[model samples]
Target: MTPQQRRALDFIEQYYADRRIAPSLKEIAAHLGTKSRTRAHEAVAALVRDGHLVKTHGGRRNIAPAQIQLDRFTTAALRAELQRRETAHG
Candidate 1:
């Protein structure tokens, strides 16, 4: 994935961590410093395309992290990486 897309995913994950819920399109746009929700929606679409996140239903901010297919060892490693990054930058 591109850096911009990675950053958007990081932001989305952090938003979930911070708020204990998904962010709305407007919130995502504001967080990304974009001018419109359309851009935010686009970013979200990109993330979904890239398999980093998923949206539920068709209303509100019902987003969730995508499951990664990994062996147990790799899964632990990835979880550690996510935790480290979240703590370092979130």
Candidate 2:
């Protein structure tokens, strides 16, 4: 993920964890210390483009992680691949 996409995902995750609800673009921008909601929206759009997130019901505040139907093997493979990538780049 690009830095912006990663930041967007991090913001969404934190927002959900904190509020138990999806945040609006304005809220996200505030959380990210951005001056404009447009920047937050662009970051969210990038996340959707990368398949890490889904926008729901044609709304700006309704976003969720992409649905994944993973079997144990597939889940493990994905986890390992993500770890490998993180380790390689970090």
Candidate 3:
């Protein structure tokens, strides 16, 4: 995923973990050091598009990781590929 998408995912995960609530577009923009909510919205949209996440509403909208239905082999391969990418990049 692109860095912005990753950051958006991180923000969603961290915020929910900390507060048990979803953050708004304004909050996302502020946390990412951007003044435009459009940019944050784009990032969030990418996450949703790539099947990495889903958005839900409970008064305010929230992002969460998508539920994967891959089999064990596919899941393992994906995990290994991610690890390989991380190791190579890091």
Candidate 4:
């Protein structure tokens, strides 16, 4: 990732950590010191493409960090639940 993109991703992760929600493109643009939201959008798209971020469709605040670190206990519990399920599900 480019330095600019890394900064954007860091800001996004921090925003989500503080508010439990993703910031809007305008917020990202403001942090990035650019009036054009298109630049922010492009950075987000690149991050998503590189698997550093995830974005759900049809929402203004859908972007989030993709590699959220989980505690070992929580990871184990999630794995157990998945094993119990009959079919693979997202």
For model 3 the local lDDT of residue 13 reads 69
Backbone clash total, candidate 4:
0
Candidate 1 lDDT over 1-90, as tens digits, reads 776667777777766655546788888888778869998888889888877898777678878668533332355666777899999998
Candidate 2 lDDT over 1-59, as tens digits, reads 77766777877866664554578888778877887988888888888888878877864
Model 1 stretches with alpha carbons more than 4 Å out: 67-90
Q: lDDT score of model 4?
A: 0.82
* Residue pairs of candidate 3 with colliding backbone atoms: none
TM-score of each: 0.65, 0.61, 0.63, 0.73
For candidate 3, lDDT tens digit of each residue in 1-88?
8877778877776665455456788988988899999998898888888887787775566676575333323556667768999999
Off by over 4 Å in 4: 69-90
Sorting all predicted structures by TM-score, with the top scorer first, yields 4, 1, 3, 2
Evaluate residue 47 in candidate 2 and report its C-alpha lDDT on the 0 to 100 scale.
83
TM-score of 3: 0.63
TM-score leader = 4
CA displacement after TM-score superposition, residue 25 of candidate 2 (Å): 0.7
Q: Write the per-residue lDDT of candidate 4 for residues 1-90, one digit (tens) a residue.
A: 998899899888878766657899999999999988999999999999999999867668988789753332355656665677746553
Report every candidate's CA lDDT: 0.74, 0.73, 0.74, 0.82
- On the 0 to 100 scale, the lDDT of residue 85 in model 2 is 93
